[model samples]
Target: MPTSNEAVKLQHDAGAAPTAAEAVRAIDGIAPTTGTARQVADGVWWIRLPVAAGPGHVNVYALQDRDGIVLVDTGTNAPQTLQALTEALCILEPNHGTIRRVVVTHHHPDHIGLAGWFAERGAEIVATRGTLAVAHRMLHDKTLSRTPEEIDFAVLAGMKDLELAAFIRRPKRRYADGVAMLPNATSVIADGETLQIGKRCWTAIVGNGHAVDHLTLCSNDGLAITGDQILPGMSTNLNVPADQPDLDPISAWRDTCRRIGEHIDERSVCLPGHHTPFTGIAIRSRQMAASQEAVVSRLLEHLQRPRTAIDCLAAIYRRTLSLAERAFLFPEAVGYMNHLANRGEIVGLRRGKTMVWQKQRRPRGDTIRREASPAISRPYNFSSEVDESR
Candidate 1:
């Protein structure tokens, strides 16, 4: 774990470096899929299928047992994703008759989109209490469909109209806690709980940050099913949802990464929700930690000049965005900014409809530059020219 002193020192040192895009590209390069798999380890198999929106593909893992198979993180509920999962399951374990349970790592569409589909198939959907609570709240009230509720929620959080409207376009669904609606969810697994499937027993590790109650499963066979908790290529989004105003997701994510590093060894095969299964859990954890630290450092630089969350996002992404993309970017941008503010590296001041940020103090002799004015100011309009560059 990085101490506050160490974090501050690193933050200051990092500000003297190049832009975030340069640092990220130098570290992880471009995000690429490592392709899906059949069986990664003993009794553990993964199916990487594509989704219609955002981040393209998601991986679903199947733990084979004598009775049936237990699935971790079903892909989106789309027809193509469903068909691919069915085929993949049949190929992995043809003798298996039914999916006994579906463990949702979090409530993202790529992760839980097929929860209802699995429920229809009589597979019990399992998730952490926090995840389930948020899922239910978002789903029951049709929050995604209502524009006014979105604007109200965003404005309450000090967001602009364009930011709130971007969020309202996405479809949302709900799931309650305590295993009532999902079939065969005999019990809710808390942090550090052990679950038995067929002949194997896996330990559930509850983590927050990326998702409210992200669950990463570690089996005795040296395999850890890390849904979106840890990805091979890209950094997972640590979003500040409209529903949860007080949660500090960036801190939660960093701590969760450290906790995951402590629980799993370096050699344990990581079955992530998006990328290919690979070893080096510790390496990935450290990289994620550094990446987050780097984000904070970049935000600190942005705070040198007073800027809103949208301004910070545009500066960092450096590309035109869609409504859905802006919805994803705004919270993430604000989350990291908020993390820095909590660490006393940045300060926030509300100005009418927007919240502006500025650095607490100058770091050493680093000189800050003003952000260039955007050529196009239209909200949620990305031209084909910009799309080609992306």
Candidate 2:
């Protein structure tokens, strides 16, 4: 059985392949308790912060600068996170002074949540332009309503009638709830830009498919502060964009994995946004890309009959999804559907207010051979289980 954190990551990827045993080796066997700091490298400390829900903890790094510290990826804006961060900072203050700068890896609520709080304390918030724009919008926007595009996308995912009405009426989760505040001014960093954080000069590598322009810092000494783009033990989620419903993020994600793999070697120690520090980054990145390919391949086979994205869940998932899992995994299913459609392997047919997908018929001379998947029997007629009408 996987641990809670590993289970959460599996759910995030909608049941992607398990982490390869030899791909990554954890540097630290166990993580430090909340409010405590663990030194991972010279002038670099790992601080785990408590998360109210999901994964349970997020890892932030403190780099010792000449005058103070440069913190990367602040935890959520919750009280427990703030308390833990305060204690961790106090623990590092004797050697690192105070936090002079904060480098946001992404605009996710968990990573950038406390950025505003730090900015208020005179810490320079540095992030990519895409990240800053999205973070600012999510932090400040309070109004939540399903746009016409969103509703249409939901319908295409097989939601309609009472179910669609209920979904529309459901209170949208607010990103502001996790974030403290947004700073009026932010220092924007670009991809491939060399940053002088502390003593080591690091290059910023921007990746997509997880978040818009997610930043990962790589030092010449082979230490990488990889955010969610390249997690060690499990695959990250590639959610379909809400605004661009037809956009395919899986392709971007695969390209990113390849690029990161080429950039970082096996000897590099990677400090991810979650999970313990690990090595064999090249292998892990390849594993992630291959795992996603397997998912897409499996999804292709499951498209033998006309199905909705919601109905297709029965085909890909290893087990039944919980309520919370369903809410998050819905977008992932849509992502897979879009990927297939974009590849010309499937076509969506409008069925009333809903859209169903069927495998695209290819020419006899232009057939695409599919890899053989393990034989597993699952009942296709899972109307009771999917319950799209609910």
Candidate 3:
């Protein structure tokens, strides 16, 4: 793959193609797919597949197993994605294009949508029990993610009546819209289960938040397959669903951050779901925790006066919001607001028919907690057993 960085380096320095060494240092910095697989490690290859709609491609990894290739994640389903998948498979696993097994990290549309695509072709699908359960329900009922409860929640967050009416009339986004088809069956993977892929033994370190029971694979040989758990460039969406009003995703996400820093070595390379894979995970994990906490603190200060979750959107993101962005933005804003309420920093009271968050005390604006030890520990002791449990 010709990295955008590689081209710029060519003009600045001598003509030097992207090297495995450079890719090892900063995988995300490496140019995306040049219509072929880029070797990130000895037996691991990186493949970038186009999304139906997004800024760039979704990075999928293919590991060499004894019998055939073991895929970490599948890009979203569609003819366009299938075309990209076939082209990459032709280059990486040309022997018989044999994908012996497909391991999914979570139940996100992009990661789980194409599980059936490979399963239909005989690859055994692997994912958490919760993920499979949700997939089945989504296949049965398409409009589950966005219901009247969501509209009501949005109104509680302060979305105007006109926007709410327009949104309900055009509730086009649904769970099934992202997932092409559900695999009839999946060989479920539990937390702390070791999987032998290629020459390494990878263990499934399941953590809560960011899609409950999200599995991040930590290999014995200092390699971690972090599916959206530990992305390089951006933060994962930690939102609370309208139905599960009690779930604290930020706290759950913090526990996952601790697990990554504790289980995975600092020097180990993390092959993430999006962006480039990178090393130095210990530092990155702490940075992520601090950044998230700062976002929470910022919101709490904004809540000194009563504010709806919708009103808090501007406090977090100062720019204009898009319809697609609001789908995520509202939930995450509510999640942070809920975290504050849970911490006794804010109070959520019924303002007329909807809910609004107000500060419990004078806002402790931007007071970074100082301690002898680390900032994050075991996180809040709540687990999203799944939507059913919620």
Candidate 4:
């Protein structure tokens, strides 16, 4: 149910436990705009910037404070993108000079694209160490080649020859190309740290699974600037790339969602990176968690017999895959498999150039569940329809 942006995304967001209606309204009470600023809160303005990747747009928020304008997230680094931001700010504050602070929710290309530009102009960019570290590392490093690694992973995951050839022959330096320019964060904001942007005090709530460390800032009063951590209706991607093949974004994402739902006040209005900025975060959070768990259950059912990630794609996703869709689906396929493997719910066996996953085949009728820390542990109930004869 992720829209085009999240649907095409191989990622998605959630908030604390709130009641959600299918038809949620935008806080600004305006339709989507390419490059215009509309006031969404008492002192915060919402600006949408079109990104080339994923959903083609990112929502940039500008908060007015006594010192200057504080931005929750900045769009990419293109001339037009920068110009749009300039126009919005000029109109918001005719005498604006400096962007007092730019708090990045994560280190993605679209989000961090303009941070460097702002930072160079005396803006103090604030983000977690993970965001700051990754931005600096990916920005300066050039050889962004992952062909060899990806080819291996694809083959092992059961990609078809035509698809494999297309995937490998295509561009490989995409980790950088996915966004504009990644700007490094100057101030490393830690989780639970209270930052005084203007008159309001915002606490940093660091999350993960989507990005290693996603930052969601919650105002002391009741508002939140949640980057991609929690979109109103979409779920963030938790795909595990080959570099960190064993990592479990699923568990990490679950833990983060539950924590936010428990901590953030029920009445908070969160400003997300995409989709309409709306309330009902608490229900949306539950929706996301349930959606992810549903995927896990589907994967389990598909594993009645030994299967590879590619085999379970049809079960996890309801749509057909185009080459572009593969970019999102492949990682998602592997992520679910890896999550099962991590929890000992399944095991993998190598076959020639590929690997196949099979149910771990637990003892008699006992319902199996993932055993993790209190932050992320969840039970997985198997359907009675599953054939144990395999």
Q: Candidate 3: where are CA atoms >4 Å away?
A: 1-28, 32-34, 95-97, 144-146, 362-390
lDDT tens readout by residue for model 2, 1-390: 012334745653543234556566899978988888999999999999988655777889999888899999998888999999999899899867999999999988779989999999999999999898887887777878766877787877887677678778877678889887878788999978988866799888887777888898998778999888888666777776667665556656655555565567779999998888999886676666556656666677888888898777656565676544555566778877766665567788888877788888886335342221121111122123222211
Model 4: lDDT of residue 77: 73
C-alpha TM-scores of all predictions: 0.75, 0.87, 0.83, 0.84
Return whichever of 1 and 3 wins on lDDT. 3
Q: Which stretches of candidate 4 lie over 4 Å from their true place?
A: 1-5, 8-19, 22-29, 95-97, 144-147, 173-185, 363-390
Candidate 4 whole-model C-alpha lDDT, 0 to 1: 0.70
lDDT of 3 by residue, 69-117 (tens): 9998888776777788778888877752489999888887778778888
Q: Itemize residue pairs with steric clashes in candidate 2.
A: none
lDDT tens string, model 4, 1-390? 122436533232232123345534456556346656888777778888876665767888988778788888887776777777887777766654457888888878778888877777778878898887777777766764545777787888888778877776676444454444534436788988888866788878887777867888888778878788777656676766666655566767766766676556656787888767877565565566656666667688889899878888777765566775675467768877767776677888988978799888888554454444343335222222222211
Q: How accurate locally, in lDDT, is each candidate?
A: 0.62, 0.75, 0.69, 0.70
Locate the minimum summed-lDDT window of 10 residues in model 2.
372-381
Query: Judged by lDDT, which candidate is best?
Result: 2
Against the true structure, candidate 2 reaches a TM-score of 0.87
TM-score, prediction 3: 0.83
The C-alpha stretches of model 1 lying farther than 4 A from their native spots are 1-37, 143-149, 156-186, 320-324, 362-390
lDDT score for residue 381 of model 3 = 34
